[model samples]
Target: MTRRTLMAAGSMGLALVAAPRALARRADSHRERVEDLIARMTLQEKAGQLTLFNDPFRWRPGNVNPGDFDTDQEKTAQQIRDGHVGALFNGIGAEQARYAQRLALEESRLGIPMLFAADIIHGLRTTFPVPLGEAASWDLDLAERTARAAAAEGGASGIHQTYAPMVDVARDQRWGRVVEGAGEDVLLNKLFAAARTRGFQGDDLADPLSLLATPKHFAAYGAAEAGLDYNTTDMSEQTLRGVHLPPFQSAFEAGALCTMSAFNDLNGVPTSGNHWLLTEVLRDEWGFTGFVVSDYTSERELIAHGFAEDDRDAARIALTAGVDMSMQSGIYLAHIPDLVESGDVAMEVLDRAVRRVLMTKAALGLFDNPYRGADPEVERRVVGSPAHRDLAREAGRKSVVLLKNENKLLPLPKAGKRIALIGPFGADRSNVFGPWSIFADREMGVTFEEGFRAALTDASLLTVVKGSDVEAPLDGGIEAAVAAARDADVVVLAVGESHNMSAEAQSRVNIVLPAPQQALAEAVAAVGKPVVVLLKTGRALELSGAVKDAGAIMVTWFLGSEEGAAAADVIFGDHAPIGRLPISFSHYSGQQPYYYSRKATGRPELPEESEYKARFRETSNTALYPFGHGLGYAPVSYGEIVLGSETLPWDGELTASVSVTNTGDRPVDEVVQLYVRDRVASLTQPERLLKAFQRVTLAPGETVEAAFTLTRQDLLFIGRDMAPTVEPGWFDLWLAPNAQGGPHTQFRLVR
Candidate 1:
């Protein structure tokens, strides 16, 4: 039925929610009892419960199924009729989901309900800031709220499960899809992952507004070789569990429903087919019982990893290794039965997998009410709704990173200003949309022109110049752009990679801008006018050349549809930009994975290194813009920290506070970070580890004390034997915005 017809029909979910106390309890109470029904089902029926095939009706193919399935339409339909297919993916719109539900309930022998899952990563219909961009906000509460908004919108659009809050700690800029994760900060990753999971799976699972949270690519896929997407990840075991594993652990603790395995191999083993990662680590130790689902045909891709010989072998290995769901990769359809009959895979294993899947559906209130998501009216009213867009705009505002403001060049004056907005990235809607945005309304994206238009009530004096192409050089357009830049009072050049430049499979050799584009930027800077460079892309680009002598610089990843307005607002003093860096920006591309926290290499590189030291010839190990680096319209001066407890036992606690003062003419936000360094511990240890952080807003010249409390667990690390423990020794504490800064105090540790 159409949205209008459904709304007019009216006797739907609201009816159940608004019913009388006794009758409402009786009808809706059945949702909580869905688990009992699944418990009584036979093994064959239980396997059917976990089997979610694609519903070709409304959820049309974005691409063909992962190689294991028969790509032909007739074969796919026949499988659904075979009564083995359970849930489906990418089916949007209520009518389509309802139709799929009808097929499962009416066509299948068991009349089971199909669980609908989709990649509602950031925003479902109304696109929000990319996860990495959102990480710049460093607001866990906001992250959770954004997840709720996404879940509501996705659920309203007939999406039951959202593959979201991709909590990978991305350090490499070459991986284009690192846009989906928080970059290289364990504390940042944990906070956002926990927030998103809680938001996706809200207080009540039975609420139709909630969707199951699938925090994914279950391991350190972000550290892929040379930062290449879908490439093998090799890291020390200590780095893996301590740095990369925290986000997954936090997401799991927040009650995530499912976890999707990564595309890359762990060590030499493909994650989808690795029993140790799935069973020994995730389930047995970490206690992740919700379920493990393979990424889009990841099992079939194991052959490409050189671990499996064929699709069948890949399926056998993955399923036996603890993968419960075969997403898009149709390997199970062709081979699971044979493997079961051959006694290579036990029926009990299948039963346990099916049990987990059914448990999730039951938790979602899907089994009792097959028509859970069939509300066409709610979909129309709430799809791309105003409230959701406003949230997107809020997140956009928070995602902006104001990097440099020479002599306070920012908070650009709105009145009496000849504003020249130059560069190819300023007007492109697609680049701002970021990747994995399946449903992002590119047409609706607000461009920099829109931002400028909205900020300048009367846009009579604003000049525009497409200075250079993002993917290529603007060989012919530079002359006109230079003239405009020279004529204007201030120039804002928006430049970065094109829309498809920095995501999955989008890794680069240099991790720098195209040489021609760099030359174009130099020609513009030659105009000798104050230039403000605003970067728009997924990963960090080496900006030493562009930044060589720019008046001001702003680092903004694809800032969603509302970013234009937010950027303009910050530029013109309506809002002081407070966003910080989520990933480290290196001085050059060679110092990649150049995070603030890392084990000091035995041969550490310095300006003048000793013969016994490890160092680099081409470059230094310093990043261009350090993590937690962002400039506001105002500057905040930090003072010395005071610690309450200087010596503490293993189980003792300590309280610390650092005073900060906004010593500028405008309001701003400051992020105070607390870190601890083990004076002497294992042979391999990072110089320091981030323990706590806080973001406090201050008015012009205002001051505040940021406080942090620490427990012994905060000092613990995964030992050489892989045991989480705290070593007894002296420790140094550093309280700073960036890692390049020195420590606040040195304290002794009691045994």
Candidate 2:
């Protein structure tokens, strides 16, 4: 397709299937019906429709955790009966969801169907790798399939919407929620955002197996200051629009049904009360028609943010700012009516919010079948099934990134080599399924010992040692670990953060290996056996000490249920490690907001120049391992990048091609990355920006020509006046394996 056609398609929702005339007519009828229902709703009912709360009572057997439910059961039931409750979240299973839906439909006077929502971030029951690990795969299709599986399982369990596909372009590793997002690159984040949305919603929302996808923490929550969660974000308008907003745009265009507002304030206005971000940018400019829900208690937290005086003020601000629903915050139900009655908040704003909420319910077919996804038999059949586990295993294998492999220590011989598996995660099963896997059964995950035994013909060839606790002192266990390594032909040191270390509210000031694990690595390395460091982490960490000096290092970021099996596959050469780093690994923890795509400075530190200018006094100002860097067993070589022409008209396309050859005995998949830099522009640009990339699998001695077509639209950036446009400029381009540096060529755009 032409560039114009592609842009137009994107704007018009390319992810959606073209509906038949009959379906379109039916949708119009549904809209008319929704409007009629809205007209019938009282102000109290309307306020209730914008209120979503957790199920107050725990109905599941043997577990009685009183979540965000109302303490007074009679009052809660009365509220449901009066049509004063819109939806229920954190409801456990099909039975609980059915009970809640029954109360809304059968007990309520208006009989409005309630939407069920949950934080199904990665998986429901059949867990896959955490989202950051999935992004590391760099496989859009795999990411989509993983989402599809999660959606199916979640749907079977009676979930109508998932607060997922967190498209926040996370640049800081210290940000605790990095595990919940795609890494720092905008294009990759955009692609995965769309893919996950399509996977969750499928071809039609009416499909029972599909659920609404929520791309969240709406604005720039990922760029929180000092890598702190919910911290203030201060940046230029250009940076906000250029770096953070594209993923949300992509997700919305890909048919996301809803969005969750961020907790942090952009500039001085909290996202829950930022009308410019929600209405101006999201609705007016991007044409997003979906409803926006506040993050958990975010609307009420606006008071804490000092943006609002009280709950009543918070409700008015958030409602006016374009939030349709309050998640777990009863401020909307308590205060919106008073605000609307006093004319402090417009009646039309309340009506618009209710309309959006009901529209989503209508689209999900909840109005027609309130219990669409609440099927116990389907839940039992689908959740954690054999087929789902296979997919999890496949995803885990693809997510493994080989950061270093000196002397070809990896793809270890499976038969004769005696392996010593040592670390906190050596025989541990629970920590493998990382954070946000709330519903996953820990016992179901494959442990490291289990995986090694499955890969080897004889289980006797492996000696397992606990070594030391993840963060605890070495004590005397390091001696035992060293002795085991001495007896074995090779040592595989499994080390990194525990499952609770890298998720929400789990931020770390020091992003390095735990002292005990580092000490164990040193002791194991002292034994003289080749050491392979298997890192199971959620975010990037500073590779230092003996862990960095190990013969091989593979980052297996919380690979979910099949982590052990997946690691075994790569270690045994069953699968090549093709995954690339979605985020850059900083050399030290002090580089809080480091990424590859920073704007060029006038006095930039160049390798050829002296150290006096813009250089760090103690450390090198570069990522330890740059973004898109990964290694496989087979070696691949890249020829120089070739441009179709040195200069082109502003509206025309420039074709860039490069030949990549696999010069090893084994076939391998190579991720050919294309980067571009605007040499001069009205506004300064990143030194290099990833524009296009292709993953190609090649056999021994096989060379493939990878080409990309770039148009003026691809080079568009936010200018001085905060308008996006492509300016006439000389553009330097690169075709390489990673984002650090490679062969370069230049092209120009002319008016």
Candidate 3:
């Protein structure tokens, strides 16, 4: 169905209004329960439900570090008793959550339940690969399974809601938060968003194993200027609707219970106070019934953003804009009631926001049993279980993308060869889990040395050397690394940014290996040993210097707890590297906003033509590694692309098929990607846009046909008039492994 149609249909169970009275009554009771609670609440109590704050007692057990603990805990406790706080975030354990929930249930006048939330972005205790790494796998089922495991662990920990599945379609690597989202493609982001939402919420929110899924940074937070986090965003409405908003729509359609508003301002309007985005687009147009929460201090930041006069104005604007909850801002708590009483903020608006928050609590069975998922026994049995760890290992393994395999240098022999693992990440344990892994036990992750030794025939065959500290020069580090490389039969150089280098507020202007590490890589490569580069990073980097010329290059994004084991599995040929790049790797840091689906420029720089037109003086126009690019043990070749018909009716289906053959000695899973382009349009179109993709596993010498069906709606675009339209025109289609050149064909759409 079209977005409009889907929006009009609303969420699941809303249709029960027309069903049998018994079923309808059950659905009606949810709303009735929320209404009844609101009736008993004072204006202050109602405002409290729209406010959320961090847990005061979230510090590690027995450690109780002074500065880490909330100093205003006494005041906060009184507020909870007075029904002035709706939710608590960063509640570490079930016991802690239960303690806070008890304050509201037993001590408060209304006995309302308080919601607990946390940033379970990738995983909870048993960390999985970062979101970008998982996206590289291009395996939707695996992504869903990982999300499910995260939800299970989170639910057991008394986390009623998880701020996760950041579905922002990020194209720039310099954006630090890119690690939290799926990469550049809209379709890929949409599919992963939907799958993750389903995994987090499951079939029912009332289930004890389920946690409320929140697809966050509601709109266009990923397209920050110069790839800086929380930077200003300026784009046409067409681009916003076509590119940035689809994933959010997909997540909502998949039954997401909440959305987190972005910190960035779009077109001079802070997202927290942008009524067009939070209300008109999210609620009225897209029919998202879920509550919208402001990003950390985002409502208060509206003053900093120059969009509001003060804290009171910020609260009023955000409330009117449809932001139901103010995260850690205290704007809603401090000023919401006065605004409501003074008639600056309407009572209906406050009630609407309060109702939405209460409905979510009811859906989670928090009203019936606030501690439904907060069981100590369940926490002990499920959190970081052996089964979850195994899944993490598999997820990490699949996320590793073989970027360059020169002369088949990978799948190193398990015996005979002396392997030297050199670089900062060689034996690093803490950095493997990456960022936003708040609850993960760093000690649980296997070190590279441990994993490699386990995979080797003899433990003595491997020697590990910490070549240098990340971004820091270590005295004599390069010399020690070079000596180790010279003594070994081959060298595995583990290098890339540390976890902190690519998360919130960590944007880098130079997205290349640090100078010290670049120097270290060159020194080791000079030893003449076959060097394999295992790049452990959260975001795409400009691979240059000696590292780019290594015999093999693998992009192993922070593969969470099983990083070491997963890397060893792929290196030792226990598993084939099948991941494809979801984002393009630029050759130069100057290519900050580079992507494969760029619009056709007026002065196009065709590879086959002269370099005088739209050409860069220092670098080529192409990406270092294009989107969907990767290699496996076996080589897969694409056959001729065949279309069922040369012409398709406006409302009819067009089937496109291609035969893929595994031409090597081993089995391989290949991602068959399909791209389409409009030959002519009122508004110029992208050179090619990703339309369809599927992963197929084929045995040696096996050929399989993969087909994709496209309806006229698939070609729809936001036209110059700012409405979706599919003009009758000629179109070009290509089937390939990546965004690079491939076999092409042409077709037409006719009315």
Candidate 4:
């Protein structure tokens, strides 16, 4: 049939079968037709369609082509024509995506559609707070709903995919990817993952606003050695499936259609080529029918990990192991055909992956209208809309953790305080926008200067001093800044890494604040002024000196463009800073991956010679501030816990409840946490494990109750068989401010 004839026929079918979908099918036969098309494709062709891609942003800086493509435009053209290169990433935006996709539909022999995807992590055009910041909000429902807006805006931008809901558990503050994930609690991660996935993907994949939300890095990429991105992941298989996979499982049950492999290896097997992880566990065990994509260049990196001999071997191992998309490994594009012909890889493997990919695209209506993503609708509604911005702002506020508020030093009277805003982050719009913030507008970022102006009026008379640069030295401005601090009532010392300082491949041997800035803050603090230290960093930086010296410390884990105003509102007492720390603030780098929920060592060191404890010469086992620690202007006190039952069996349930009251004068919010200690187990357990937590707000002198229903699932650990199951034992349940329970109460469950 001629192209015009096919177009007319397709449009006719579209009118009758245009799936404005809910519970009804436009036609069950459409899926079958897609299946038939998949059946007709060759192994190489199918694998090609399953090849995943990122947008142009992953390209090294100033690489004119966006990504590090060497004659890649032409390669893309050939791949599309060959019915290969199924997914696209890292383009300039929607229009660029549309133009690039034409190479697939018009020139490709099969006329199969290409999927356009982007890293719509926080917001599209209107940036939201980073995921870590959003986690601080303790508003899972809101965060998720905001994600819905993100999907709508992203979808409106002609994008059908988002690499989001990065639910990796960041136990180590040094891991750069921590900025992309929810914090260290299993329950929190589950809730955040569900909300974010539902928001990004929407209720139905067929909805244009609903991009295929992919939960990624398959396993823990957050617990990298020294908290570096794409570093080695070493964990027992039992621990892997227990703490890490729960969030992913939650995402899957919520309808995540895609999974991305990690750049790291699990137990010496690279995730991109680990069948035990990709197929047996994620797919076969969990029933994740979605196509799995390798992380950028991961399949090829198999050589680096010593898992594969070369690119050709990597392709064979990856496909055989169950990767649907190569994701720029070039392994598939380079050696898949040879492998298939050599009988090293099966054609059926490629075909199966292709079937899944094409099925999703067909569901997305890519075949009926290949350019469906790049419509004027997306441009009109998605980029920089108020709704999107509001979502981002809310996410940012939620993520901001109030680390200190002793003496009620916060909620500074917005009307009367002579606030002196110092430090580099105070006026930087760039630092607030973390890595993977593609669609967020950089220029519109709210700096601390803007935040102060918005929070405090002309009556407050806010003064500015560039005390110390968060990115670089002040060029000898410290003396002048200290002078400014002495004259002001409050000095807001804004500091942290530069915007580009803590992202991917930006690992550091040291996590201290820059020497110049640290010295500057010390000088300013010596002036005897009350200072609020606002940190704008991607990864956690050492804060022992600052914590010991500053009147207040706030872990602003890189709030986005709207941060200035939101932070101002919280700091100056307009809004109480109720947010809690998502990750711990270690006193020293020796703590490396220090977190509350960590496995205890077999030898469990004693404080022999006083040097055997988990302490460094420079700092203590104690973090500058502990995990789950945060401050509010008004004080909150917890009442005695009332357990529904003191003891329970493995199959039985335990109910833990407590009453919390806002004891101090203004209204305040408190996060009541539940932690447990397994008296004994087959393997070791964390010194303390966070079980349940709830964020509650009460007016001054007002009291409220918080409760949690605990089941066998809540007590589960990865068994020797690698199945998630609970052990038979007595458990100590502790309800307190941090993971460490204030007093021990016994609960028993026998398997």
Candidate 5:
């Protein structure tokens, strides 16, 4: 097993170019050039192509690195020059990126171009709402637009790839990374995954404004036990296929060129070393041609998982198991070359990994011009540009979920009113970008006070008070808040978890309003004035006390750079709150691992009979705010669930329609959700599974019929045999607002 073996294997695709104009006509195809380059590479160079290193001095908080390690800049530079580092993360600016890339292309032996990657989860310079918040918008187009804006900023900054659109279906609120993904619905996860993927890569990877989207963490990282990060995940094959794997499949289908393996093990096998996941499912079944990169040091962590003997074993297990690239660990660089030569790892494996890297760089148009968009001027012009910020503001506006607006307390008057804005987040400039926004400048973000002042007319008066810290009470803060509430005609209480509280390694045992904030809320509510609770949070929190009883409540999940502006837009009635709960909000932390889709049990709790019927004595089993739950300024009503036919042929489709009318004076945008339940099947099915949804707008007193056509594919589920199959059976359907309850109908799937 050697370079000769690779060259011989790919000889048919290679064409020789003479020296006369070798530079101009070196190759006609990427395959030819990549194969030729592989042929000329040493084992170390091939291993280097599989290694991804971090920028030592440029590391920032919130960046994804599993372990703390020391680095020497000069040593790393020499490694890049010696072809021992293939890619770099931490996202150096355009100027620095150009310098490092020049070192690799001009100084390295093979002159291979290196890739630059960052975790652009939501946005780059112009930060947008976190992915979980954005999912609440239920606007695929907006999701795509935000991702496009992120790609534009990142590409201009010389970032060739982004580890983003975390498609994992996060079900547990305690999982800090839950804020990084779309909620528990498989359909929404798939839709958003596809949308963000397309947005990141656009239609052409060669486009300078496009970025390579890496959908991760591959396969059930979200299902970690106890909602803990990097914890073991064990599940039945059916659950794995049915619940966790579809979004990754959707992202790959949407043209994601790269993927990162999860840190956690799946059913006892680490994903970074899971042959069944990376090879059998991803490559052989789904036909994902992109290379698989291990999550930061995940390859090395295999040893800690007891799945490998040492670093060498970790390298062998991961690479042979189909992990193409190793991030940060340097385990691949340390052991891959030796493993390849020792007959422990095949030469074809090494060549395949190197080839994938080369092909990706080729797709990014790096070989044609390694300095793709590596211009300081371009970076300055595109990063945090006015257009990108406007898109962010629009995204922020859409991400707001009006959880409780009793008696229509929201859409407050914008003129001739005294308003009081209180709480820690009121005028705070920091923590607005949420997690994974390492590049955002906090100073540029808009605060709640700023937004309120800007939104108010000249005749209106605005007062601000920092009622309390996030987790502790401020001295006389509650009194000041109460005083401000008494003085103003309306009160806006802003509070919740800071950016750090809901991000990686920041999981909490209990998700509730801090005691001090709750006290502040209570004090403000006691003032007996109209109150609006601006809930700035990431995950679905367990609500209690005054915060829960506030007249109006909005989940404004850390709306990025324009957080203030967007909040103001919704608060002042310039824009309606359009976000719905992507994940369900439980009444208590005791209800762990909650989701809308659940299988029926023999001892199910009945609505009327709660005694000894698998019911909790202290609380109901339903979510406080169910999935897809949200309210707008205007009132909307659903007419009825209408089906075109009582029966659906196995090979044909069925149509379901619901007439939605805006009854209130203002316009209403409604998300018409279509859910289906297989009444009887070989394997137990969820009570209801979301199959389709549409967002429609209706003017005052206007009605619109929202229709969804379902094919056999929509009914297909993993059956007893562990294969996707649609069984002939009666199915219950719901045309609803949310997952809990809606207008229902039934249809038989006739075989």
Candidate 6:
């Protein structure tokens, strides 16, 4: 179904508007129970249901430090017992969650079970590659499996909900939060959103292993001004609808139980209090019935944004704007009751928010079993299990992008060859789990040295040297690295940003290798040994000098616990590098917010054009490594694009097909991407828009036909009136390996 169809057909809350009789009846039953509870609740209790608190004593299994305790633990605990807090976050451990749930159930007047939430961005314990890196694999099933595994582990630890699968369409490599999302393409973001939602919630939310999936930072958090986090975003409504809103819509359609409001302001309004975004679009348009929760202190930040007068005004505005819950902010608890009593905020509005929260808890089966899925035994068996580790290894292996392979120098021999593994990250374990990995254990991780030792029969053949710190010089480090490189037959230089460098609040202006690391790379390359640059990063960094000029370059973007083994697998040819770049890698840092789907300019940059054209003097207009670009052991070739017909009926469909062949001797996986562009439209369209993609495995000398079905729905775009429209016109199509150059054809949409 098209997005419009989904928007119209979807229902609010846990059940469809047009659900089956049995489902409708159950939903009615849940609503009745919630209504009864709400009617008995005092204004303070109703407000409390919309307030979420952080567990001060974040108790873990057998690991509790008194110094790390929240000094306000007594106050928070009393508030919970007094029915002033309905949810808790930042605490893991089945027993701890059970204790908190018992306090709410047994002590509170209403006896409502408390909800538990956490930032399960990638994984709970068995850390997977960062979400951006996972997107590089272009494997929807892999994304789903990793999410499912995380849900199981998190569920076992009594986490009722996970703020995950950040579906923001990020184009700015400098933005630290890009590491948490799929890259710039809306199509990829949409697919991954649905996959992760399905994986986390499974077929039923009541399932013991299922987690309430929250597709978060709702609407355009990625388009921050100058690529800075929490900055204002001023764009035309059409751009918002076309670029930013699609993924959130897609996630809602995929049955995400909840969503978190973004921190940034859209246009002139803060997203926390933007009624159009939170109510009109999310509810009336998309029919997201699940509750909307504010980001950490975002509701209170409305004052900082100058959108609200005070804490009371912030609480009133957020609730009226359709935000059902306040996270890590006491504003709601402090003023919501007074606002309701004084007729500033309606009782109906307050009740509606409370009802939504209650319904969500009911959907998680918390009403039936307060301690559901919080089993200490299950937690012990599941989190960081061997099975999960194996999945992480597979995910990491597929996420490794082979950026350059000069003369096919990779697939190094496993034995006899002397290998020098140089750089700070060669054996570093502190930064493998990229970002938002609160529960990740560095001790569980395998280092590059350990992976090499496990792979090689003669461990003496490999030498590891820390050439430099991530951003500082090490004493005599470069000299030792050079000596090792000279003595070895091959050198694997691992270098990139630490885990802390590419996450929230860590945006950088100079997005390249540190000066010391660059110097180390140049010195090591001067040794004249064949070098493979094993780059570990969270976001795309501009490449230059000897590191970029290395014989082989592999981008391993902060692969998690099994990163080392995964890298060893790719280096030893056990697994071919099948990952593609989800985002563009630019030649210079000046190209902030660069993407493949940019609208065509009046004066386009062309090789044969004059210097006055849209060309940059410092660097090339194109990316160093374009989106969807990657290399494998075996190269794949694409044939001419074949269309079903030159003209397609306005209401009819057509097929775009291409024959892709594995031309080399080895088997390989190839991602065949399909893109489209309208020749003319009411508004200017992007030069090319990614529509469909497929990952196909081809054996040596084997050819396979990859096909995509195209309909008017596929051509739909937000038009002049800010609604989805498809105008009859000629559309260009490309069936290629990546977003850049491909075999092209055209089809006309005729009335």
Assess candidate 4 and give its TM-score to the true structure: 0.90
The candidate 1 region of ten consecutive residues with least summed lDDT is 10-19
Candidate 1 lDDT over 1-751, as tens digits, reads 1222211221101111121233234334553454465555554455455555555667443553334333354555555556566677776788777776777678876565778888888887787888988988877777888889888888887878888879888877777777888887777787788788889878766577788889888888888888877888887777788778878877776777689888889888889998998998887776665788888878789898889999889878998898888877667766777777788788778767876776666667776676876899988887788998888888888888987889778878887889888888767676767777777666778888888877885687688788677766665778878888888888888877775786667788787766656776788888788888888877887886655468888877877778788788778878778788888888887777677787777677665664556545665677778887887877788888888878866667677788888998777888887777887886566776666677888888798987776666677777777767766788888888776673479777787
Question: Candidate 4 residues 1-751, lDDT tens each?
Answer: 1222211211101011212343125224366776777777776676677676544422222332225544446655766778767877745355665776777777877777788777778777676777877887767677778788877877777788887888888877766667778777776787788778878877677777787878888887776877777888898766676677778877776677787888888878888999998998776766666678777788888998999998888888888898888876566867877887889987777677777777667666676667765776567766677766776666666667777766767767767668778887666676767777755667878887887787666734777878666645666688778777877988888877775666666677777887878887778888887888887776666775754567788777767768787777677666777777767777777687777776556444454544565446665456667777777777777778788887765666677888888888988888877777777987777677776666778998999987766766666666666654567778888777776435457788756
Better of 1 and 4 by TM-score: 1
- Per-candidate TM-scores read 0.92, 0.95, 0.95, 0.90, 0.95, 0.96
Worst 10 residues of 2 by lDDT: 6-15
Which consecutive 10 residues in model 3 have the weakest lDDT in total?
Answer: 10-19
**Candidates' C-alpha lDDT:** 0.76, 0.85, 0.86, 0.72, 0.85, 0.85
lDDT of 2 by residue, 479-513 (tens): 89988998999999999999888988777899999
| Decoy 1 TM-score against native | 0.92
**Alpha carbon RMSD to native, model 1:** 7.5
The per-residue C-alpha lDDT of model 1 at residue 146 equals 83
Instruction: List residue ranges in candidate 1 displaced over 4 A.
Output: 1-54, 59-77, 605-612
Q: Rate residue 33 of model 1 by lDDT.
A: 51
Summed over model 4, clashes come to: 21
Q: Where in model 2 is the C-alpha error above 4 Å? A: 1-27, 57-75
Residue 8, model 2: lDDT of 31
Measured by lDDT, the strongest candidate is: 3
lDDT, candidate 3, 42-122, per-residue tens: 999999999898888553322211124354778889999999999988766876777888899999999989998888888
